[model samples]
Target: MNELQHETSPYLLQHANNPIHWKAWNDTSLKAAKNENKLIIVSIGYSACHWCHVMEHESFEDETVARVMNANFISIKVDREERPDVDAVYMKAVQLMTKQGGWPLNVVCLPDGRPVWGGTYFKKDNWMDILGQLQNLYTTEPERMMEYAEKLHQGIQILGIVEKNHSEAKSNPNNIKPLVEKWSKSFDWEFGGYARAPKFMMPNNYLFLQRYGYQTQSKDLLEFVDLTLTRMAYGGLFDTVDGGFSRYSVDMRWHVPHFEKMLYDNGQLISLYSEAYKRTQNPLYKNVIEKTLTFVERELYNSDNAFYSALDADSLNEVGVLEEGAFYVWKKEQLQQLLKEDFEMFAALFNVNDFGYWEHDNYVLIQSQSAETIASQFGLTENELLDKKKNWEQLLFNEREKRPKPRLDDKSLTSWNAIMLKGYVDAYTALGHEHYLTVAKKNAQFITDKQWSTDGFLWHSYKNGKSTITGFLEDYAFVIEAFIALYQATLEESYLHQAKQLIDYCLEHFYDEEKQFFTFTSRDGEQLIAPHFETEDNVIPASNSVMANNLYVLGILFHNGYYEKTALQMLHHMIPNMDYASAYSNWLNLWLNQSDDNKELAVCGKNALENIRKIQAEYLPNIILAGSTKASELPFLQSRFDEQNLLFYICQNKNCLLPNTSLETTVAALKIS
Candidate 1:
């Protein structure tokens, strides 16, 4: 056992035996830097990050490198997954300084914890050069170094102020409509995804398009979303043999994937596809959702019902070690040998030509072909072809399972739990699957029961039965959003009440009253010199945006104008950062939809509740529902609302259109948009 054995973070545990004196991010290390007048070096990365692993092996484990690092600086290691607050602050600094940033984030700061200089993944040979340069600059030109630090600090402060002001402005629906239109115009028509070389899933963009299409009844919006999703489903970015999507495509056609699979990414994408299926009634979309869920269950889901964080892109194969996509590719001969008589038909359906589809090697994902085409080609009935395909898929899935699986990072993160919870909720509603709801409730309970702190705050993550890191804004915001969704799905008052509590905690602890935006960390917590307010969205939605949505829903549910006003204020503050919102279209859409003309559907009493649950089982997004049912009793009525002789009031914009308890009338009211 090593000294870091006491740490709960998977990343820290991975480095437990390293010769480097790596301290977890804490006040102790920062204070030590101040007391010793030594530079503080903060290295940030998550467990599944490939470069982080490489740097750990190449430098952290080297006794000579560790000796130098320990002697010269107070080294602190942070798992970005565990402490996103710290990562966000310094990642911004690194980006500002270098115009780029990534893990392993290597930063050197002054005794006061103001970053002076930073660069990521210094080679062992280059480390001596970089270290020598920094040390010389620090010792011989202390004044110059301090001046540079002060300038960086001031720059960050100014950026913070500007971001804070921008996040407070409420965007007009009209302005957002044009913004959405502008982004849609830039979408790649020939290819399926957004116009870019390296393409991401961009589930947010698809979600916005879906909502906008439904809201405006725009054919183009609907077509755009459908095309993008269909293309992604058939692209190599999605696993055809197994379920789940890779991180992103490295090429334009979505043929070559970067190959890392993240739980949060899959969770969000599954919800997106499931919603798409609900809207379009497309069997392909539904199939994609089911397969993705299977992938999660097979690989990421722990025995405890918690989902793991991610799977590494790299893997070891018979041909030795390889980069991402190694395990996914296959030669045509290999498939021919495996499938025998079915080889040619299968190859044709999967676009496996002699020349190959991706990098001259077949990466099998459904490219183009309806079941009708397959049936016609095989001279069989559609049902027969479907059965054969199912059996063939099973065979392929079994073979793939024999290969070495990607490394799983089994650290459970609260933000990711919130994501998966939403996925499970969506799956349950869309498919009417009891197991999905069971998993959702179990995971939600795990988070609240296990990760909740004695201080009445939520911790960010848990690993091996221990929760350690402090929760950031995203943890509070996203989890509350999940609870709200769960409340709507189950019509459980407890989830709503719990969500309200989280919202209150965030407002009290994280809200920057002066700045008019939420801080990433609480004011009373271990102080980083510059507390950041994240307005821009990343892979997950921004904390500010999620919180803004939470406030909006809570305001409507509780009829608290203060919460509503706060939500609007947050939108207003964020409007100036509209450029940033381009990448975060889903959140912007949610905010814009609320700002336009928000509707609340309140289902009261047993009869109305039964009808409402039936409508809710359809998986309608953006509708907020409040019920009077007790938390414990809510899960029993998981099925759609039963038609009964109970009075139900359908309220939109606080106006109740004639109360009718019948299922038909309730369904009619819900269908009114």
Candidate 2:
């Protein structure tokens, strides 16, 4: 029986009708394996993964392969997104056995669910051959299978292993710069991003580079940062017509991307671009930031105000054949017909020539030249070209909408949605836009009402009016981080109070006193083969790393040295791998922040909200803003309320300068003193 029909995961639903008899991961499935004395074949993948879809079509759909699987093994289909804990254990096992790991991960494990052999995305012939061999070896040579499982299980458990760092222990702030310069050699200065074929838009690397370049006044570094951002915005990685970035570019030039847009990627990119815009006031960054948010609101957002996880990579084309990038790619004839008068200029502006070609005479709509430059070539003023361009984009966008839409994974995750929530908050802070703030507060309210429990716990995922799975450290850490951002955005004390409660809950449940770091699962959740502590940065910053940053920021908010020390210790354990710090850029950023001169921009009076809005218009990453319309006792807000004038003051480390009765003098004072 296919138990996947009972599962809530979209990835599982995508396979619910497979020829194989599939069971969703549960005690019943594992128990069936043990009771029947059959090997367990655990296949894990996410809904939007392109290769996962390919494998499903090739192997899982074949009746012959289904017979082999159903006869010899108790087959379980696990959605990596919904059951990441299970995926993590098996993925680690696969990576240990084979040097690489990705989804459509197939792991052949013991009846007890201890992984013995694993690999990803095999063809029908290859799948049958491997399955037959594994089944034979398991039954005929039980001792060999047991040996492999025992050792591989131990290896997977120890992979996230943390170690002490002498560089961090020495407490020298100067040590990080040389390593940053060394690691930067890999950057693709001309094309943007780290030099590679499949370029992921790892937002942390650019965030670190931009901040480090600005703080150190390194002109070359700053130029590299700007070049990267500009090129990426112009590239196919960014959706020019619609909005939101794809997963990554398949080519080194960022010309053609893997069209699926993950919520986490767009959310982090929005936050990154928001900060970049604040620092440089670049129109390109602001444009991309706003457009991406528009895409989120239009597509990824659920009617209930919660964000969805992703959009599938494959969709039906005009002829209804399922194809990758079908929704995004365009034939030249389609564009030429739509923009008959403006076709020549549009083609030139977007590089619809052979240079922009992807596959089958289609272009991904990547911008090769800016409108200003293209306007000159077309014998038109910039404004005239811009007017034509805007009109053309809307027409093309509307036309594209009439085509088949990609499948949306409607599962809402606490961690991913929280990241998007922080993105909106950052967008509001950078742009001083009320709409972004409204969106952020709306999402926050929805999470509090839906995913969160009245008893102060969180659920991991929600879909179709049902929330399932226990919340992991990531859910707690990111929500805690988002709540802090919310408090800073609104200064609503309830937000702070909620953040504190979440953090306390994390400390009580996720923290390991011996390791001094968080395990990925809560103490209350079912333990995996081994408890995992994710501390490295990948596509997402490690949950533990994000938690440490929350502790550091919360320490500043509450003047708690103990919290600060714990955050410092977490960094200390990671700082020895200086070259790897590029991947750990979030941790390094937190470390650098420890020495940053803290600024408190306090606005107190009946008109404090207006003053806060004005003060926040500036890009002050190192400052904490406190506002009160009346008297308050909060540490950051103590005695800040004024009865007479709209008083403003600048304070540093508990020493405040003379209070100003006007916002003008206060803004000027912050300029130099």
Alpha carbon lDDT of each predicted model = 0.76, 0.85
lDDT by residue (tens digit), candidate 2, 1-673: 3778888899998898998999988888888998998999999999999999999999998899999998999999998888878888888888898899888999999998899889998988998999999999998998999998898878887898787664624455566688787878888987878888888988877787777776666788878888888888986889888889999999988889988999999999888888888778988899899889999999988877899999998999879988999999889998889999889999998889887999888898877667789999989998898788778879989998998999999999999999999999988988888999998998998889998987678999999888888888889988998998887678787888788889888889888888889888988888777888888888888898899988987776676787878898888887765566667888877766654444667787888877777666665565666667778766667776878778787877667887788888777655422
Model 2 vs. true fold: TM: 0.96
- Tens digit per residue, CA lDDT, model 1, 140-202: 998998999999988776664534554434456767776777777677886677788778877
Model 1 regions more than 4 Å off: 1-5, 17-19, 56-71, 121-128, 160-171, 319-323, 354-385, 595-597, 617-622, 628-645, 665-673
Clashes of each: 13, 0
Model 1 residue 458 CA deviation in Å:
0.8
Error at 670, model 2, angstroms = 5.9
